[model samples]
Target chain A: MTAEEWEDFRKGHPKAASLKTVPLPFPELCATLFDGNAATGNPSQCLKLQHSAVIRIQTSRTLEEPKEDNMAKFSIATVFIASISLLLTLTHSFSLENPTDRRILVLVDDLALKSSHSIFFSSLQARGFELDFKLSDDPKIALQRYGQHLYDGLILFSPSTERFGGSLDVAAILDFVDSGKDLIVAADANASDLIRNIAAECGIDFDEDPSAVVIDHGSYAVSETEGDHTLIAADDFIQSDVLLGSTKIEAPVLFKGIGHSLNPANSLVLKVLSGSPSAYSANPKSKLSSPPSLSGSSISLVSVVQARNNARIVFSGSLDLFSNKFFKSTVQKAGSSHKFAKSGNQQFATEISKWVFHERGHLKAVNVRHHRVGETDEPAIYRINDDLEYLVEIYEWSGSNWEPYVANDVQVQFYMMSPYVLKTMSNNKKGLYLASFKVPDVYGVFQFKVEYQRLGYTSLSLAKQIPVRPFRHNEYERFIPTAFPYYGASFSTMAGFLIFSFVYLYSK
Target chain B: MGRSPTTKDDAQALFQSLRSAYAATPTNLKIIDLYVVFAVSTAVIQVVYMAIVGSFPFNSFLSGVLSCVGTAVLAVCLRIQVNKENKEFKDLPPERAFADFVLCNLVLHLVIMNFLG
Candidate 1:
């Protein structure tokens, strides 16, 4: 009987039939036998057995009669399911093209803040981030599960929390950043010591006084009731199109919070937004008793740090900058005549978030290659004064896909002790950068180096070592036309010697 | 001021004395002097050529001019040593001096040929 008929008969009379009564179909029998032999000591031996069983099944199928259409449909359905599952597993892993953080954990002081900051959270969600919200003091809160990090980014919004619950602590957060994850911390007036320590670790120091808030008299926002001049309308943003987006911020950002200064010794931290020259950080409720510790343009309202491992962190002095209320608030600078219907808080926060999440300004270089002119194969060592071409393809990760990274200032250096040849590479509109130059006359070990460090983008440093050799003895040109006069002079001297010898001997 | 002869008369007298003195030299020494003059004139011609046409092939220019100058210097040394009246080289034979000059010329020409390119 055909395999299909046997399968139907066995299903219809399961109680009457036994394994001894009927021989099973080849595939089903092999599957059962392989499962019975699962206790094999070596995994490789078990695999061999399974492979042999599959081959036996194929041969048995050829010997048996043809099956019904239902059997083909069943096998096709199983294959389709298996391929879909394989595809799903492949997409779960991290990929180079989509480098933006996927999952983020947001810690807040209370669950009510979730609703208060729903706008920012929704923006992140709209950009395909899976945000996990939890209270800072929750006992079950953990940054990691088992041995793996549960999230690719972290958001600390609980500025007032003195301590965290569970195993989470300052060291744990630093370790998270050390592993190249991103972070965003927002602080306000009376920021807890714990939050201050975190900011200090990132090379920023908040004002010493707990009551100190940023006070800007010259650029304060005009309000219905004039209070402590603490409601700052700050337009002094860092002039970077990559960090702040291409569109100019039309209205001043409304900031009402404390201010901090970047550490002088730390080069990684940068102030994204600064206070006006007249601004100072002091307690506005009390009279001015002494000069404020952080004042003027040095008082940074928003700062960012890019670690050596390329982990990004954004520190904002005020959590209200990201609040729904400030996002909807209208404002006018005290000295300016234009009254913007809405503050620039929404655009500013969104753009900065985009930078911290690595949706912009992430660059990667690939396919670095060098070869002699008019040749396709790369030589082991280059001859001195040989003409060669160097090429590299650079692409920027644009959140969802890798796009061509085009810039005019990228340069390649042929370096040994110092730069022998530094050439600015020309690029095709599609992101292939190339430079052609003759090797220097001197021969030594050399390196092809591209050290690209722009303002907002992650640094791209690539160096490839190559040796350069002097020309061989036979490689020199023999009969040069320019040297004909010298040859003639040398040969004429020899001729003159012969003639002089003959004359001197004959005359004597 | 001291009633010195005119510049033209002085030049003529100097040339006459030099010619008479050179006439006393040996014939072989005179031949060496002629060879020296030829080498020096060739060197001068090459310098003038290098000036008009730029010295682009600098090694060639150097080799050409140096070879001629070297030949002239060697010939002059041979002439000084072979002069029979010179007491300083009375111990050295003229045949030996000529052999030394020939050997030095060969070495100079070999180096010049290598450097010409």
Candidate 2:
């Protein structure tokens, strides 16, 4: 049996997992016990199963088990039952510490999206994610069952869904993100209030006009016929290698959707795809009597937010951006003769989804250690001027494994009420960051702090408290050469007093 | 023109009379006067030395200067009490004043020695 199959069996029958180490010589005997026959102490049942096993082994002697249907079934069942009795263990459900999202729940407005956006879904599936598809109004759907999250991430493709069924609501979804789960939301021109509210909570404000669609006459895609200029060939993507893969996306992504304005107060939100300078959002059918609310390069085509909990969310202005039509379509920007053989939408969607799902840019810091110079063991309290070394190992999740995150700007701060020493750490190219500094002369409770916040990477905020003490009484210098004159003068004064008193009394 | 000669003669006369008056002072009182001058000069010398060299050992510097000043002041008190011309302390014996000065000097020297380091 494969590891995944063994894991599934172990999860399904935890009671039998403990008995796995006790080698089951008779598979038929264990099958009876596992099938709710523990109370039935019948010896004849085991004998009957043993008789069946002998017949199967004799028929499958040539090892061509696939040719015999009954033999294959019996042999596979025996292997599964044997593996199921072997181990009981605990597993994480896509934790941030693990930084790998294994399961996802995709909610759609229509079931036809399973066929329309099959490419994007298939890419996630190919990456080993178990995606559960459900209609937006499916009453039996739930994010968590028995207080345990059923999915590690949520993908909202239902731009027109006004109310989600079951226990999931605006607050429930927000709560899910607060607990460090990932989310991906796609909105169309007729985005309902529910979808808009979710986007607004993520620091993205969709155009207030419900019918408004992003219309760009300057940089619209070059179509065969003169259209309403809603199909935009946007190319302004955020310059980040960690969010977007290292290989550059050469073509402009095709977007046919509404536009949004990121909240200025929200510092965590980033504009992944921005509208062109001439792009504006309004009802394309009506006359432009007033200026559009969101226009110019400020209009965001796609945005992403990384919460303080490290949960990631991506908001796209168009749901059709993930459709097969856009993924397979060729793109040509207006006034540009050069045409891209394929749209950049597929690469853009794949890379950005990798980021939102924590496959990239996820960082973990461990084994934080500090000790006095020339000493291997850490002291409880540091002397005022003792030199010390601060070390921390930081690694980035590379989808399949942790890799060394090499950056020249990682820093460590020796902080009390304020930073006393702020030094940039030097990495050994093996993920170990080192910074050595002398303890400040001032004595108080101090902390070794590392507040690393970089663009497109999970922020690392670590603070380890330490105490600093002044020198002991015996630690002071016994004698100083500089104070010799004062010492001589004082002693001379004592001698002079004794001599003058004797002289005065004897002579007079 | 004759006024210059008169001025020079007047200054000479003043000096002669001051010398005559000081010569009448008792030998013990004169010795105390010399002691006060010696103590005062020593303190001045130490202060000048402190200025030349930085006052790194501040407590030692203070004790050194205070010891000299205390000795000078006690000597002056003894001189005052022993002077028969000064009647304010006539009832107090000169020996008693001498004993008091000795005891005070001993205490001052002990404190200065302790503070020198």
Candidate 3:
């Protein structure tokens, strides 16, 4: 048929036109054809099959038409592609409202390290993370393609690589973090300058002596070789349930790498693991040089930083901490008879990975609402001495899902120039936190602020401004009985004037 | 500090002269003076009551004291206009003064009633 004739035919038969546009499943199409043919009573089964056959034939014929039909077909194809791209863009946007990152990119120096660290990698995979392992020097590797990040997190295990390929540099890695992505960096003894620079950017300074390794002669793990006291056993972990799992780690962790010190000015960086008081960083092969630069509790074995944007990062001085060998190795600290069959590396690695991947400590607060007591609708402004209740729903991302975050320290402040009402909120065990307090007996522009910062959770800072007004003139109580004497005196004065007036004018 | 009969005689003479002068005043003026004295004493009594009972109802205290003070003032104005010896208000009539006093008292009572609460 000609194009005009086909258009007219489609308009005349509305049912056929709709069927052509919306491709239905076979069974549903059969049902629809059967229903349509039921009224005619003309052998419905045969008619249903015949209708579907006719539609297939018409669609095929339309596709094989001349170039004159290309305009309409091209527009339809373009619309379909556009809608799919829009849907993908919507899913790719990073937002704290949904604190789950699905994809990760792991960079390693050698392919053999992948097998050595398979325990750590498998743990991440079992948690629903799509890990893409690539060599650090791969020329085609790129963090973003066409202004879209391919992964939500980056793991740097290539401590020896001097430089990265493609557009990946220290700045590019920092840019990824600035866009609210997580990072986990592992460096070893004699780490390359590039890795040291990245650690420096995160407010950590590695020991300047390249040969220096963290040596704890007093707390060194008892090994069979009895070599230089370079292998230290670290038991001083940060006392935080969120960073480390709730189950206490009984065995000390094994460390055989360089040590770092945190920058005093950077408050965001926290020393998650520290060396023993007898531990010091000095050249293991050479004699004792000038005093060690990093010693005692100042040497941080592992540190974590939660950036202002909530992009978490973990820096470990030893890449072997994540290795399966270290995880399975037995550890017995010097002068201690308690021998652990398995080191604490596995649990420590898993918990720190969970934290860095935005799975443990990420918090999201939503539906912040406040209204007067016994009222449902929020008011634009409040009056002084008003009894109000504030509510907020907070959830923590537990690797795979949002779970209720329960804590007793969440507080809300009714603040103008200063806090007028500071009350600790009560929770309903279902993620809803509520506080009921009377608005202070002062009127001004005030804000309902909740600044909740826990030990390891992401800070929840919320402030909503509202105005408070004084009572209107007509709203005041009138003619109180306590002032009846004053009222009587005033009225009697008026009466006295009237009586005195009459007497003075009439008495003659 | 010597005990002298001259000092006692001087004080007695002063009281006698003051009584003689006050007795010469007109009866109507004297009646107005007595009314002023009554209002002033009532105001003093209210002040002492506030000092003892505390000014918890400050607006009531203010209205009570102001009413008595206002009455004393109006009565004094009436006394001045009807004295027949005060030359400043000789042209002004006592009835006119009483009318003004009644109007002022009415306005004062109206405000006090509103503020009493």
Candidate 4:
């Protein structure tokens, strides 16, 4: 009997089995002991015991005996399950290439959003993220459970949901980002205070007017009949391929929503797209009363913020920015004859999604080393005026792999209170940067700093503390040419005293 | 005319007494004074030489003049101790003072030799 047959027999009985002997042909006895007569009392217990012994014997020899097909099948099944579990663990570990974010908790107004924004949802899904979608009113919506973070990213697409029904609120949302989670917020014309509060935490202010929509008179998309020019066709996007997409946006993006202003105090927030000079935020159906609070080019159509904690947030006024309709719409400026078959919304949304998800703008610095030009080991301390070389390699993550980050302005500042020596590092195309400089004459605690912040690239701020010491007395040169006159005078006086004393004494 | 003759006679008498007192000075003391004059003159000559040719080797010039001055000073002490008319150094022997002066002169020259050039 095989181990499986014995286990089946053991489960069939209620009491524990004992180790005993059975008499029959090896296969017959093994099969009979497990599935023998349903004997009651001591006899059944004895039979159960015999079955357990036989099962143990069979399993002990299962690996050695290839003839047992059942045992082989059971072992194969265990191996398959173990391997599958190991593969799952490895997949989860490699999911978040950048530690800034990994798992995302996507809260929506309903489960229907999972399919409505399938294009955006699937893009994140393909990137090895575990997205848990819950209705905004679900009592179980939690950013953390038992002090451990439940998610690393959040998407606020439920613009109209009054209040998150669980422990989640405006404060909780801010805490999630403060702990370093990437966020993408798409606000409509009537976005709730919950969303506006969240946007404020990210240093952006949406128009306070509840009914105002982004209205552009000059750049409205030309439709069949002349209608309200509330629908804008904007293409004056930021000219950064890294921030937007590598491909130029040919078609104008159709936007129908409110406008926002980035906080003047927050330097990290940037306006990616601006409204035209004629555009203003006001009630489209009502008569003009007071001056609109947000108007003209001051209205930022799209804004992005990189928090001090390195958390990324993207705020766009229109929730339809990611909708299939805007992605597929054709656009023709009101006064222009050119008509593009598609809008820039799809490409803009996709590329911006990739950036918010950390598929780009990820930087890693490694192999920081400094030594004498040809030496391998770093010295404990640098000598003043010594010629030394410093090398640091930098690479940027491009969704799949690390590629060399090439730039001419990457500099190394040998700093104390101020930069004593600032040198631009030279790099090979492969990302290996090298810089050589003589240590400054001043000696004290100094730092080698690389403060690299460029548009569209994640800022790389690296500072390594090092001590530079003055040369030891013995280390100084024994003879100096400029000071020879001083030395000569010191010795010549001694010689003159000897000659004058001899002459004076002899004359006396 | 009588007043003019009397004034001339008084001046001549004073000169006569001064000459008689100078003739009483000891030969060794006169020799020491001559040596001091010679040392002073040599220092002055060196100073004039420095003024004409610049103090390029100023330390050498200092030690040269100082050595001459030290020798003359030691010689004057010896002359003062040996003088028969002097009472302050009556207990000090002329031979002992001379030996002391020679030893001090040797030490001074050794220091001067080390200091000069």
Cα lDDT tens digits for candidate 1, A56-118: 766877766356466888899999999999767545634565778888989999888899888
> Candidate 4 regions off by >4 Å?
A1-101, A481-485, A495-508, B1-117
Candidate 4: count of backbone clashes, pairs at least 3 residues apart or interchain: 13
Name the 10 consecutive residues with the lowest summed lDDT in model 4 chain A: A16-25
Q: Against the hidden reference, what TM-scores do the models get?
A: 0.73, 0.75, 0.79, 0.68
Pitting candidate 1 against candidate 3, the one with the higher DockQ is: 1
Please tell me how candidate 1 rates in CAPRI terms.
acceptable
Error of 4 at A379 (Å): 1.2
Q: What share of the reference contacts is kept in model 1?
A: 0.71
User: Runs in model 3 with CA error above 4 Å?
Assistant: A1-94, A139-141, A145-148, A500-508, B1-20, B23-39, B67-110
Candidate 1 segments whose C-alpha is farther than 4 A from its true place: A1-96, A132-151, A163-179, A216-235, A248-252, A264-267, A276-279, A295-297, A328-343, A370-390, A412-424, A435-449, A464-483, B1-21, B76-100
Task: Give the winner by TM-score: 2 or 3.
Answer: 3
C-alpha lDDT (0 to 100) for residue B85 of candidate 3? 84
For residue B25, give model 2's deviation from the true position in Å.
8.3
Q: Each candidate: RMSD to true structure?
A: 11.6, 14.5, 11.6, 12.9
- Native-structure RMSD, model 4: 12.9
Tell me model 1's lDDT, rounded to 2 decimals.
0.88
- Which candidate achieves the best TM-score against the true structure? 3
